[model samples]
Target chain A: MSLLSVRSLRVTYGGIEAVRGIDLDVAEGELVALIGANGAGKTTTLKALSGMVRPAGGRVTYKGIDVTGMASHHLIRQGIALVPEGRGVFARLTVEENLAMGAYTRNDPPGVSADLDRVFELFPRLSERRAQVAGTLSGGEQQMLAIGRAMMSRPRLMLLDEPSMGLAPLMVQKIFEVIQSISAQGVTILLVEQNALLALEAANRGYVMESGAITMEDAASALLESPQVREAYLGQ
Target chain B: MDIFLQQIINGLTLGSVYAIVALGYTMVYGIVQLINFAHGEVVMVGAMVALWVITALAGSGTTLPPLVIVLIGTLCAIPACMAVGYAMERIAYRPLRNAPRLAPLITAIGISIILQHLAMLIWSRNPLAFPQIISNPVFHLGGATISGVQIAIISLSLLMMAALTLLVYRTKLGVAMRATSENPEIAGLMGIDVNRVISITFVIGAALAAVAGVMVGTYYGIAHYTMGALLGMKAFSAAVLGGIGNLAGAMLGGMLLGVVEALGTGYIGNLTDLCHVSWISSDLAERCAVDGHVILFGSNYQDVFAFVVLILVLVFRPSGLLGERVSDRA
Candidate 1:
């Protein structure tokens, strides 16, 4: 059974539809990528699935339970976490505090402490600047902190949005490596990215979205080699 | 020199009250960006509750110790104010949270009006004389005199501010509050219940305001339905002066504003005397002078000084003396 299943999810902002009747599923331990251009409803779908945006229609099930319209914090307790678009680090908080906040729902102090160490080990730069305010960190460091924070939640499923946006190539490469490592650790991932090539390469399976609907879905290698995908997304 | 020292003491005492109240404004604004104009009404409610409790106890001829009576009064006031603060957030502020910024602000004003009228309806418009809970003799410090009440006000304010600082910077709850203030959406994603954190913020802020309200009433020996209006405006100005979202900034701003007003009231006439404005006609200058000093300004103009400081701070350092804790717009 899939870890997460969204059937005909819809989201609207103001009077306009953003994500319209889209369905998707992520099996346990699979790294699935959703690739689309700007305004293709990729972020909105992620938001709706994570409960940040309430779906105007359809059901969201997690682990075969109907978890539709559940609050974000509730979803976190059920082992779902979203590292939001633009790396939403608490700017006024120190790096250490941001990581601490990531473990907010957990009451196990010793476990939290161990997780904290693990996160620091995962991102050594965050450890180096643990006491520094997050706002002062560089964009790459902030992105790292965002991912490290999500790891502190010990989520079974992680939704990553635009992890490569506005980063230098080296930093993007480092981030993709981290994503690969996280997936290898048996955490299911649903990644949304406009960088189609990198996302498809990192993911086991990929789905193409256009105008608020999925246009194609296949194994990542197949999509990577497809002539249509190459013409539109790979810029080859 | 003695008069100058005396004004400083007076200023510090008044400043402490403003600082405590200003904290309420700063904390609430930091999290929700709501002005909570009704916050002033919370202060009034606190003072009224304290007054009612103390009066009832006294009327019943309960011979409690003065310290115990004051403590009980404060204990009563804090919770009452907290309830009002919580209700304001849940009933008036929460539903309008997603509405345009103007909606909550206008609702806050409406809440303030309702609170004022409710107090007036219950407690009446007459100013009740606040009983002296601490009647200790005044002490002398060099040239300036210190009343037991003034010392209590200053020390308590400092203690509360210290406790608040520790709470905001040291505890897990403080981290959650700060996180929510920084970005509610992201904080939610991190599994922090933003609404709970925000509600707690309002409660803490209201508790502080309650203490200030009780202190102000005790200091002035009067409590009335309308007393919070001017005091609230001054405290709000202090919050702005310190940088609306900065805690330490609010403290500094409150004290600075208090000192300026006190000093301005004491010396404005003398200061004006030193400045000879040629624009003033000789007849008018003569009429404005009292005992060879131009008395264009006096203690009556003390309130004006707060507004002047506010305007000056707005024009010069809009971010406040301490820069505001503004989050990055995602």
Candidate 2:
């Protein structure tokens, strides 16, 4: 059985249908990438799965429990964390406060402390600037803080949306490395990226989304080698 | 010098009242961005209730201890105002949360009107007299005359403000409030019940307003139905002067406004009269000055000061004295 499964998920904003009947499954410890161009409903898909946007149709099941229409807060407690698009860091808050906010639902004080240490260890840059307000951080540091914040939640399944949206090439590489490291630590990852080449390279499995639907799915390596995927998304 | 000292004390005590009420406005605005027009009514209700309770005690021809009267009045106001505040948030504010911002503003205005009339209905149009126990003793400090009521009101209000600061900065609820204010969606995702937090904020704010109401009642020796309107407008000005969402700014703004009002009454009075003499064809500047009555912006200038401060703050520094830089629309 898949660790997380989303079936026939449809999300609509007003009359515009953004994500139309998309199904996905991620096995335990799998690094699954959802790659598409802008407006292809990549962010909407991740949002639906994390309960940020209530699905208009179908179910999102995590470890066999349907979380459709469940409050996003409840889903977080159930161990699904989404590092939202644009890296929504609280600008007024310190990096430390942002991390503590991620652990807001957790009651185990020692575990929260342990997770904070781990996040700092994962991104030493964050530790150095933990006292600084997040708004003052460079874009790359904010992205790292966003990911670090998600990590602080100790999610069983982590959803990352456009983690490399506005980063230097070196920073993008660093972010992918962090994603890989997070996956290695036994957390399932669902990464959405517009940078298809980098995302497909980093992911174990890749799903190609287009116009609010899953157009293709295969092993990341196979998609990287596929003529259609390479021509359309990989910019080959 | 003695007169100057006297005016300063008067200013400080009055300013203390404005500051206390302004803190409530700032706290509510900080988290919810709702003007909470009913907030002033909350103050009015508190004062009226305290007055009625005091009057009842006094009407029986048995005098309660001064300390006990003050204490009961204060204690009664806090919980009563808190309940009203919580009910307002839950019934009126919460349902309109997802609605357009203007909807809540309109609702709050409506609530304010309701509360004003509610106070009038309960207390009648007459000004309720405070028990004379509050003004029993007048202490002389150097050359300035200081009353016990003034000292209690000023010191107690400051104590409440300090306690509020501590609660906001140090407690778990404060953390939750900060989180909700920063980002409600993210805060909810973190299991901070956003609505519950908002309600708690209202309760806390109202409790502070009640404390202010009790203080104002004791010091002024009267409570009237229309009192909240003037106090509300002044507190709102204080909130703006301090920067709307900034907590410490509200307190500062309140005290500053109090001082300014006192100084205006004392020194600026003659200066402003000079303006009246120089600039105005008595008809024009007088019209623009406070009320159109007698002197010093006529006698109604006090009512206009709050609004003048509000306009000036908005025009000069839109972000306020301590601006919270909100995220710009992408």
The best candidate by DockQ is 1
- Which CAPRI tier for candidate 1? high
Name the weakest run of 10 consecutive residues (lDDT summed) in model 2 chain B. B291-300
**Model 2 lDDT per residue over A160-179, tens place:** 99999889999999999999
Candidate 1: tens digits of C-alpha lDDT, residues A1-236: 99999899888899798887888989999999999889999999999888898889999999999999898989999999999999999888999999999999999999999988988898899999999999999999999999999999999999999999999999999999999999999999999999999999999999999999988999999999999899988899
User: What digit string (tens of lDDT, one per residue) describes model 1 on residues B1-330?
Assistant: 498999999999999999999999999999998888888888899999999888787777788887788889989999999999999999999998889888998898899999999999999989998877667679999988999999999999999999999999999999999999888988888888899999999999999989998999899999999988888889999998998889998999899899988989888777766336634586656554644555566678889988998899878887788965343321
Off by more than 4 A, model 2 = B56-64, B134-136, B272-300, B324-330
* TM-scores (chain A) of the candidates: 0.98, 0.98
Q: lDDT of all the models against the reference?
A: 0.90, 0.85
TM-score of each: 0.95, 0.92
Candidate 1's TM-score on the B chain: 0.93
Best by TM-score: 1
Q: Model 2 Cα displacement at A191 (Å)?
A: 0.8
